[model samples]
Target: MKPANKFRADTIRRLIVFLFLFSAAIVGFGCSQPILESNECIEARDPVKRFYSFHFGNEMLASKENIEKRKKYLSKRLNAELNDRSDTKFDYFTQTADYPKAFRAGKCDSTAGDRVKFEVLLFWRTNEKNSQRAIQVEMVKENSRWLIDRVESKE
Candidate 1:
């Protein structure tokens, strides 16, 4: 065989091998990504997530506007008047915690399969110190969507 032809064939084989390994690596990484469960756990955790995101003291736990927007995710028992508003703001220089610091779901207690409970962790920092809270969220199914009915800080 000619030397030039031999060199071209060797180069082609190396290119093929590299392409195969690259494709395999991509597939391997994609498969290893975490899969989120589509269950009461996620349903119960989502609202508490939003509440935690807005917990800068300047934000109200339940404002008239937020309550309306989150109404679908709240149980009627907790859908009462919105009177927890305050002008006080704990504007932090920086928020060090990542979202969904942690969460866990418990089995439903209602016979109708309408109620569920879960807990979520949140972190905040003021100039004085850092604080962590585990909030218990009670959720109920309304119109086929999970909604938060009650929330209390386990602090």
Candidate 2:
């Protein structure tokens, strides 16, 4: 083939390869995190779903690192509600060594007055029928952002 034609072909191949890789990277990052809406109200409609997606979407619940990270995050969110004076920490995660394969958002209710309050119930299935569990997620608006102030597993 002609040298000019060969050069053009090589450049086109490189450009196509670069575009493919760039698109793949973008898709991979988008999947890694939950997409949240700027409208806190819309996102607040299902705090449990959001919680599950952000907190328990990847690692097993029993993983110490995961548990500690979740606990710290919750504690930070609740500190304001605790008036920055409480040493107590709250947790709302189910603890089973068994890994959770799937979860579905259940019923949810919210109240609007000053700081909006949302209670979201989430259900998950592990390996045992007895493993069915519900989590109650409590959220309040802070600085125009929806924050999960507390979470408690409904025993």
Candidate 3:
């Protein structure tokens, strides 16, 4: 083969490999984002998350309508999660804590649209004599972000 032809062939080969790897990386990157984003944006603005922090005197957890800013974010989780257990006995304490320890997340599934489940960790420092446990929060995605739908004390 002529020198020019050999160089062109090698260039084409390199381009093909680059394109394939680039395409695969893009696809792989795209696939993981939705899952990470759903949880991140939600956790960043989750109502229960707000509630957890508010107890720390964050004030941003207030659900009062006049405070449109905070209320707006709360609306997402409030409407979906609150309504379901609104009538049930719930603790609405507003106590400040030393800090929110690291949270642990469990299995999460979001293949189906409109509804998805997320296991998250949230902690609070209480003056109670008993040991403080990591609270397991079950969140549901309502508008592209997860919302705390249910909460349980994880043993």
Candidate 4:
């Protein structure tokens, strides 16, 4: 081919390769990060969701052992409170002896600087019964990490 045609062909090939790599990078990043949720919302919700996942998966109970294992997710005050309570029958986090089968962290509401709350939906399923409950989970950002500060039933 002529010199000009060869040069144009090489430029087009380079452009195509760059576009392909750029598209792949965008897609990879999109898959890794939350598309709709803000960073603050995600930071607040993650600990609560992780805690509940552990809570519900372990026989729907938060025993002392489980609490110890998941203490990093809890605030210092909340952790102490759970440890101080003498009663083993009641769970302070769920505020009930009967636990739900599954849970979801809903939209986050910023309460104050370094603090937010999530409306967590708890779901129960049985052969004859299907029920749900909403709970308010307050989280505080401590040392650049979100921790569950308190939980209250909205019933």
**Cand. 2 Cα-lDDT:** 0.55
Off by over 4 Å in 2: 1-41, 46-48, 60-91, 95-99, 114-131
lDDT of each: 0.54, 0.55, 0.49, 0.81
Highest TM-score model number: 4
Local accuracy of candidate 4 as per-residue lDDT tens digits, 31-109: 8954575567767776788888877766535567767877888888889888776637666777778877788888788
> Where does the lowest 10-residue lDDT sum fall in candidate 2?
86-95
* Residue range 89-155, candidate 2, lDDT tens digits: 3333433344455566554455553233343434455456534555565667655555567656666
> Which lDDT tens digits does candidate 1 get at residues 49-136?
5644544333333336544655554566666633244322221111222332333343333323666656555555668977665656
Residue 77 Cα positional deviation in candidate 4, in Å, after optimal superposition: 1.2
The root-mean-square deviation over C-alpha atoms between each candidate and the true structure, in angstroms, is: 8.1, 11.0, 8.4, 5.0
Worst 10 residues of 1 by lDDT: 87-96
Candidates, ranked, TM-score: 4, 1, 2, 3
Model 4 TM-score? 0.71
TM-score of each predicted structure versus truth: 0.50, 0.44, 0.34, 0.71
Which residue pairs show collisions in model 3? 55-95
Badly placed stretches (over 4 Å) of model 3 are 1-57, 60-69, 75-77, 80-107, 124-132, 143-146
The local lDDT score (0 to 100) that residue 16 gets in candidate 2 is 100
For candidate 3, give the lDDT.
0.49
